[model samples]
Target: MALIKCSECGKEISDTVESCVHCGCPLGKVIFNTGNSWIGVFGKYIITDESGNVLAKLKENQQFEMNIVEDTTFYVQCNTSIRRNKVKVCVPAGEINKFLVKLGFLGIVTVVSKID
Candidate 1:
């Protein structure tokens, strides 16, 4: 099992748990996506939490999903030596929290939360 910080209390806890032991906050799933478009095929993207924890590395047309407590924010950044782009995503309490990452003009990155 891996340890993750509780979103409610910021305490380290097992990732396999259903709720935070410190704050009793319920766990939810956040789905991160890099669209299957041609623009995203150029480089890699890094996903992280608010604490600068690396959550996942995504390529073009790839996705990463994780369990996190309610009301948390995640950071998505382009993995590059130059012209790095970053975006922040706020996830709400739900089972279907989805976020999309895309590269815009001049390698600028953008994150959009999917509402469904």
Candidate 2:
């Protein structure tokens, strides 16, 4: 469970929690998404509240790669879960670029991307 500030009380609480501990505000289930995962070259994140309301959006700031080394970063701009500040996330590009690699080659296969 990700820790995020309560939307109603501005208190730190777990997104998986049913309600705020301090204010007793309903948080339901927080939703996190990358908008679209088909084209993940540029990483992105979207966080939402229990009511299906947008809370934060994070986008990749810069990426660098050399030889076998890779680096990708994201800046999270959040008001509730992030204390209204921008948070950075760094990850190796190759680590997250292996979903299709695991799928192997199909020679003649159609690709479909879906939104949830």
Candidate 3:
């Protein structure tokens, strides 16, 4: 059996163990190397239903707030402002395609012509 670190109590334990013997935390397969680590991805962007109302916004230098889920999508902010150029977007595990369909963010967003 491999030794794994307990995400809850920060103690060492056997991988076969279900929970941390020290803190009694649940140790499932999902817990393997997936806790408190920066996944560096997002599922999708959230958008308005109609009337083009801007609901959620993704700003520069801001850590994404929504949980990345399968088929999850967020509303990435692309505006007519120069500040919205070359924004690095991250899609978390299991939520890439779903986010694209919901938000209709299919095309590659680029600064075609900066209208001054």
Candidate 4:
């Protein structure tokens, strides 16, 4: 069996497992990727896997959700300020670092602009 680093826990694990034994992260055969688009003036975004599963969905000026396949789901609210050109994400939980790491660099992220 080939061992790979778990994206959620950074631990070595067999790539054949369906989930990370340590962190309970989904380790199915899928490559995680993100996509965003401006639909008629507003924006819509989604983080998808190679199997075309929507892990997270986001709107331009609305809240978003993450992890539909997992038992533990995280709901996050977000807003983009045009005046400062910044996007802010808020969650009720105080801890977020681990959760961010679990997502493995693909999620609903609001940026200043596509060009910049």
Stretches of model 3 off by over 4 angstroms after superposition: 30-116
Preferred candidate (TM-score higher): 1 or 3: 1
Instruction: Please give the clash total of every predicted structure, in order.
Output: 0, 0, 14, 0
Task: Kindly give the stretch of ten consecutive residues in candidate 1 with the minimal lDDT sum.
Answer: 107-116
TM-score of 3: 0.26
Q: Candidate 3 residues 26-85, lDDT tens each?
A: 653210011122212452232332344544533322222332212222234344332433
TM-score for each predicted model, relative to the true structure: 0.65, 0.26, 0.26, 0.26
What are the clashing pairs of model 2? Answer: none
lDDT accuracy of residue 78 in candidate 1: 79
Local accuracy of candidate 4 as per-residue lDDT tens digits, 4-106: 7776678887756666778877753322122332322333444444444555555533333222222232222222222222222222221211222111123
Q: Can you give the lDDT of residue 59 in candidate 1?
A: 84
lDDT of 1 at 114: 75
> Model 1, 1-116: lDDT tens per residue?
79988777889989877777888787787888777634434567888889999989888788898776567788888765255656778887635587777666565544455745
Model 4 steric clash pairs: none
Model 4 TM-score?
Answer: 0.26
- Can you give the lDDT of residue 60 in candidate 1? 75
